[model samples]
Target: MTVFEQRRQALKESLRVRGLPALLVSHAANRWYLSGFELADSQCNESAGWLVITAHGGDTLLTDPRFEEAARRVWSDEIVIYSSRKMEVVGAFLKSLNPPALGFEPRSLCVRDYERLREFVALTPTEGLVEDLRVIKDADEIRRMEASCVLNERVMLALPERLVPGMTEAQASWEVERLFREGGASGLAFPTIVGAGVNAALPHAEPGQDRLPAQGLVLVDAGGRLDAYCSDQTRTFWLGSEPSDRFRHVLALVREAQRRAIEYIRPGAPIAESYHLVRRFFEEHGVADRFTHGLGHGVGLETHEAPSLSSQSRDVFRPGMVVTVEPGLYWPDWGGVRWEHMVLVTEDGCRVL
Candidate 1:
């Protein structure tokens, strides 16, 4: 079955088990998953669009008149489009049905939207009912995500050749983005990180006007999206002479840790085990405290999603799951080194794409 059908079936089962009469998916990602209609373009258009799935297998696509044609073009026949000035129209429709319970995404909906929803109908906050349903990838979603990964890999392979010593970080970032678009990416999954020398120490550092160091480290962390799926990667390079022995040691350890983490991942393995394996590798290298971030996270329609692979996460690795294995070490005065690769969880082992 298609992803939309799988999602509908999952939510239908949840509603049945939870005794909810229907669910009102207000989050754009959930709505898109349920109805196959992407309303992101209409986020700022003052149109309160939503996807409603009834326990009785009824699916409706609620939107303002402006999106009537667009919604019709993309959604299935079961999708019932409605014209509305505000989301209250949907709440009013649901109230008229007098359903016993209306489900809302507690994690994605804001306090303001929650209050507004309360003004219209009774809402029961639900955590991860829909997001959990999205954790597993169907054949189609994985295909799209793999395509995104391929695009990202190609873009990164091309990026190193463009790095000139005099170019500012911002200029280098722009070049990478241009290459991404030219290589068939829909857009960037996240803000590109182009940090040179000490700036590379900041894991989430932003691209700036600082010039690239003549003989130091240059870290490029970037990703691109295709068909709403995303890929994230980080690669650090040397500009001139070989890096110092200290830098080389850190770089080698980081890469080895990332490799070991990927090798240790398997179906039914606790994610924490893989995290600790990488942590132990860092600790053995005497840079354990320098590693500040978790090992990795799920990559999908959203850059960071579910099934996080970290030291504290309790999720067990499962087949059909996509995650990144990124291990790094940073020093404020010096620089950081991280090597990240996306992988797919499998029955016997994991495969890096």
Candidate 2:
């Protein structure tokens, strides 16, 4: 069977084991994962498309005319086109089958759709039916992700040459996006962050018109996507001839924390351990509170996915899982320092991408 068919079969088996008759999949990513169909949803309220899969391995795509042709080209046999009355069409199909129970992704379906769908058939909320499968990358998926990572590193390494002393943060951000496209990337995984000096204190700081500081630090967090797979990385650069003693120390600590966390990754290790390891390291250094946010998260078709690395996460490291290890320290007065690395979980340990 093809990869897409295999994925569909796996999901079907999960539904069968759970005693579910069918599933109504609304998440765009989950739809692409199962059917090889890719379409961007304009907003949370707008759906690019939806998939209805039966427990016995039957599959169908319900989409508007705007995406009908493309869906047909990708999944010809299973395409259903409807301009309006989306729920009416779906209800007609469900009524014909009249299965024991119907499952749906609660997180993806909006309230109106969910309430309307329930009026036709009993709806059972299911979580991570497809996402659990996504967390584990197959051989082919790993290859595509590696290609994205290589391109991201190349773009990052070449930035020093393009960043002039007086360049504005917004200008630098634009250059990063341009470089991603020129470097053979399909697009950026997320908005490029180009924070200089005090601006770096905000972890997700928006790139502004503020000019680069005469001296101090510039922190860049960026990534590129290739073939829908994503790569994420971050680094802090010293802009002056030399950094202050405190600045150097904070950078060293963050780097060490990131390095240790990455080295600790191994199959079966609890994901929360990675977060605590970094937290403990920072706590020992008396800056534990400064280490804000989770340690890292899984990366793939989406920049962030399952198997999060954080104090509250319950996931365990498993082979074929790709995740980022980013640890940072933020100080209002001193700005911030962050270092990130992408690693692929393997049987024994992980390979840094």
The best candidate in terms of lDDT: 2
Query: For candidate 2, which ten residues in a row score worst on lDDT?
Result: 74-83
lDDT, residue 43, candidate 1: 50
Candidate 2: tens digits of C-alpha lDDT, residues 176-222: 99999998888889899988988888899899988887677888999
Q: Could you report the Cα RMSD, in angstroms, for every candidate shown?
A: 2.0, 1.3
lDDT of each: 0.83, 0.88
Q: What's the TM-score of every candidate structure?
A: 0.94, 0.97
* Per-residue alpha-carbon lDDT of candidate 1 for residues 1-353, written as tens digits (9 for 90 to 100): 76687679889998899888788787777777777777254454343467778888567777777777878877765444455346566556767767766888776677876787777678897787777877888788889988999988888888768898989999999988998899888888889999999999999989999999788889999998888788999999888777788778888899889888998999989999988998888788778999999999988878888888877888898998999999989999998998999999977998998
- The local lDDT score (0 to 100) that residue 156 gets in candidate 1 is 84
Superposed model 2: Cα runs more than 4 Å off = none
